[model samples]
Target: MNDHTYKITAQDNILFVDASGPFDFDTMLQYKSETLEAIEKLKHEPWGCIACFHGSGVFSPEAEEELVLLTRERMRKNMAALATVIQDSRQADIQQMQLSRVYESCNTKYHIFSDVKAAKTWLANYLKKQPN
Candidate 1:
């Protein structure tokens, strides 16, 4: 319930974020921090990840800037399929742009979705289409 906390669901190769609740300035930062940590913790996870963000929060200019910088700070730390989902009521342009940056900067597959099923489907299809 704390603004600086998040819920993590780590499968064998998938890390899901149920960011469906009330978030504050700190919570957004924690999302970035914990996501980097999770990627490191599950570095060996075979399939990768599908993170879902669903809630209301105040994302500060600083947090949004850091989100844009994840490419350099956390790229080498993971190769997960980072998928972020936010409601239409929210302003996630910065986050969406950040995710796009992640795809461009890192050597991993990235996709943006407003739906969980779409994101998961992309991950599964991506893994299967890759060479062994």
Candidate 2:
């Protein structure tokens, strides 16, 4: 049974994601597939992502490994920035640690935030500064 849930949508150049998780490898694979499809539908220009994570925000080690590859693929697909919002401080910290490793290894730009508004604002500003 799938223990993860996610919604993906795109508005203009920003991809909005709402997800809740204690995800496994299969879930991550599914997410990667759908997310790439969403990215594909965006305008042929640079894009950003805002992901709001709920619940435990935890992933299996294998899932985490898949995330690293996903991050790299997103970067290749012209994802200029990513903002992750997690409400729980502890879960935010764990997610930051894991995602930091993924982003750093992929040389991708990302930030973790506790507020969705702040994340959207930051992503907007980051996208504006990117070369058109």
Candidate 3:
């Protein structure tokens, strides 16, 4: 991965991924790999995500295409495992535009919320209650 690619840091139970580039194919692939690698960190079970889209709320054409492909890539892996991904929301219009695409590409139902703390709380509770 490029030095400016992205960052992966765990804050308690939250794994924060901050990317420095557009959500292009290579960048999303990096995210996919990091996420898969981070699955081992899901010691809490029923893995969840808090993906925060930074900078402009708009996705470049390349990024849009990569988003679809990356979703498919993630779905393929998720079919053999269990996970629940929740993205930190963006603008209302962007969220509306992107929400359906996310549902279409994901194998299992995923969620989106504008509230980070709320998403994290839900994940924590859900993970805490699941069987080991």
Whole-model Cα lDDT per candidate?
0.61, 0.87, 0.51
For lDDT, the strongest prediction is 2
Residue-level lDDT tens digits of model 3 in 1-132: 433355666555555555443455566666667776765554343444455544434455666666666556544533222222224334445643664565465554454555567656666666566454
Q: Write the per-residue lDDT of candidate 1 for residues 104-125, one digit (tens) a residue.
A: 7555567778888888788877
* Model 2 lDDT, residue 118, Cα: 98
Clashing pairs in 1: none
lDDT string, candidate 2, 18-59, tens digits: 998878999999999999888987647899999899878788
> Model 3 Cα displacement at 115 (Å)?
2.5
RMSD of each: 3.7, 1.5, 5.3
TM-score (C-alpha) between model 3 and the true structure: 0.57
Q: Which scores greater on lDDT, model 1 or model 3?
A: 1
